[model samples]
Target: MKFQIQRDRLVNGVNDVMKAVSSRTTIPILTGIKIMAHEEGVTLTGSDSDISIESFIPKEEDGKEIVNIQQAGGIVLQAKFFEGIVKKLPMDTVEIEVHSHLQTVIRSGKSEFNLNGLDVTEYPHLPQIEEDSVLKIETNLLKTIIRQTVFAVSTSETRPILTGVNWHIENGELNCVATDSHRLAMRKAPISGGNGDKSEAVIPGKSLNELNKILEDTSDELEIVITENQVLFKAKHVLFFSRLLEGNYPDTSRLVPAESKTSLTIGGKEFLQAIDRASLLAREERNNVVRLSISEEGGVEISSNTPEIGKVVEEIQRKSTDGEALNISFSAKYMMDALKVFEGAETNIQFTGAMRPFVLRTTSDDTILQLITPVRTY
Candidate 1:
C-alpha cells in the first residue's frame, strides 16, 4: 500500500477515527486504525468492539486533490504511533508505503520512520445494517436532543440499562429519555421520514457524547440505521456505529404524574443563579440539598443550610403561578442541570407534592421535559 496525502486532511481523518480506539480492548487488532486505499478514497477506521468510527477522505473534493494514490492497498497501523506521527509531520504532504512482510514507512519533509504494520485482513468486519428502519434528523437538532437528556443517564453501571439513553420512534415523533433513578430528562422532536413503526433502542450515553464531538454543527441531515443489537449513524463523510445495551429499559411512563398540585413559571437565568449560589453552601453538607419555599404572597426563596457551614438564601421573583403553594427540597446540582438545557427566557416547574417528582419544562418548548425527585428533608 502506498499513498501521498495532504497532511491537514490526514490529520483530521486520524483524529476523528481515534475516538473509538482504546488500548485495553480485548481484541488486539482493534488497538490499531485500519487504513484502506481504494479507487474512490481512503478509509480510516477505529474500533473497540463497543463503538466503531470510520472516516473517509476522498481523492479530490471540488477542484483540488486531497489524496494522490500511487498504489491502492490497505494496512492496519498502530493508533498510538500513527496518531502522533500525523500530528507532528512538518510538511504539506505525507508519504506512506507498506512493503512485503507488513513493513511500513512514513515520510514527511526531513523525517522518516519505519513501523511494523499488522494484517488488515485480521480486523473484525463491521456489522452491515439494512436501510429498512432508518431515520433522518438534522445534525443540530440531534445534538440538542443529546445535550438535553444525556446528562441524566446514570453514571453507575448498577442497572446497566440506565447507562444508556432510551430512544422511541413512532407516530412521526421521536422521544429520547434518560434517567438515573433520581433525575430524568426527556426530549422529543418530529422526525422527517417516520413510517409509524414503533421501535425502541437503548444507546450508550458515552457513544452519544463522542458522536456529539465528531458531528459538525450544521443544518445538514444525517441518517440513522438500527438493528437488534447495533446502531449506525451516517453523516456526510463519517459513519459511527455502537453496540446497543442488552437489557430492557425500565418503564418510566408511570413515573411522570399526569396532574400537578403546584406549578409556577420563573425566569430561567434568575432561578439558575439562585440555585447556583445556594449550592455553594450545600456542597459542604455532602447531600447538596437545596430547599425551595413557595408561597401565595412571599414569592419564592431558594435556600441551603449546612450544619458545619452557614446558609444561603436567594429570593427570585416568580413570573407566574397558578396552583397551590408548596415547599420542596432537592439536589441543587440536579436542578441546575435541568435548567441549563432550557434555551428559553423562563422555565415552568410543576410539582405533584413534596414527596413526588417535579417536572421542569421550558416555557417556549413543550417538547423537552426534565424531572427530578425531591429529597426527603423535613
Candidate 2:
C-alpha cells in the first residue's frame, strides 16, 4: 500500500476507529488497525470482537483531493504506535508505503519511522448486514435517545441483559428503554425508511455511549440496521457495528403504573437544586438517600440526614400538588440524573404511593419518561 493522505483527515479517521481497539483482545491482530488504500479512498478499521468501527476517507471530496494514491493494497499497523505517530506528525500530509515482508514506512516532512505491519488478511471480517431493511433517524435525535436512557442500564453483571438498552422498532416508531432494576428511562421517536418489519435488539450500553461521542451533532439522518445478532449504525464516512446481547431483555412495560395516587408539578431547576443540596449530607450514607415530603396544603420539603454527618433540610415551592400528601425517599444521584435530561423544564412527577416507583416527565414533552424506585427507610 502506498498513499499520502491529509494529516487532519487521517487523524480523525484514526481516532474514530481507535475507539474499538483494545490491547487486551485475545486475537493479537485485533489490537492493530487495518489500513486499506483502494482506488476510491483510504479505509481504516478497528475491532475487538464486540464492536467494530470503520472510517473511510475519500480520495476526493467536493473536488478537493483528500488522499493521493499510488498503489492499492492493505496492511495492519499497531494502533498504539500508529495513533500516536499520526497525531504528532510534523506536517499537513502523511505518506505511508508498504514494502516486501510486511515492512511499513511512515514519513512526514523530515520525520521517518519503520514499523513491522501485520497481515491484514488475518483480521476478523465484519458481520455482513443487509441494508435493505433499515431505519433512519436524525443524528441529534438518536444522540438524545441514547443520553436519555443509556445511563440507566445496569452496571452489575448479575443480569447481563440489564447491561444493555432495549430497542424496539415497529409502527414507524422506535422505543428505547434501559433500567438497572432501581431506575428506568424510556424514550420514543419516529423513524423513517423502515420496511415495516418489527425488530428488536438489545444494544450494550457501552457501545451506544461510544457511538454518541463519535457522532456529530447534526440534522443529517443516520441509518440503523439490526439483524439477529449484530447491529449496524451507518453515518457519513463511518460504519459502526456491535454484537447484540444474547439474552432476552426483561419485559418492563408492566413496571410503569397505570395511574398515580400523588402527583406534584415543580420547577425542575428548583427541585434539582434542593436535592443536590440535600445530597451533600446524604452522600455519606450508603445509598445517598434524600427525602421528599409533601403537605396537603401544597408545601414541599427536601431533607437528608446522616448520624455521622450533618442533616440538610430545604423547602421548595411546588407549582401544583394533587392527590395525597406523601413522603418518599430515593437515591439523590438517580433523581439528579433524571432531572438533568429534562434540561430545566417544568417537571411533572407522579407517585403511586410512598413505596412504589415514581415517574418523572417534562410538562412540555411526553415522549420521554424516567422512573425511580423509592428507597425504603426505617
Clashes per candidate, residues 3 or more apart or on different chains: 0, 0
lDDT of 1 by residue, 257-281 (tens): 9999888899998889888889988
Model 2: per-residue lDDT, tens digit, 260-350? 9999999999889889889988864468999999988878999998988789888898899999999999999999999998988999999
The numbered model that scores best in TM-score is: 2
C-alpha local distance difference test of each model: 0.92, 0.95
Each model's Cα RMSD: 1.3, 0.9
* Candidate 1 Cα outliers beyond 4 Å, as residue runs: none
Summing lDDT over every window of 10 consecutive residues in candidate 2, give the lowest-scoring window: 278-287
Best by the lDDT measure: 2
Error of 1 at 263 (Å): 1.2
Model 2 accuracy (lDDT, Cα): 0.95
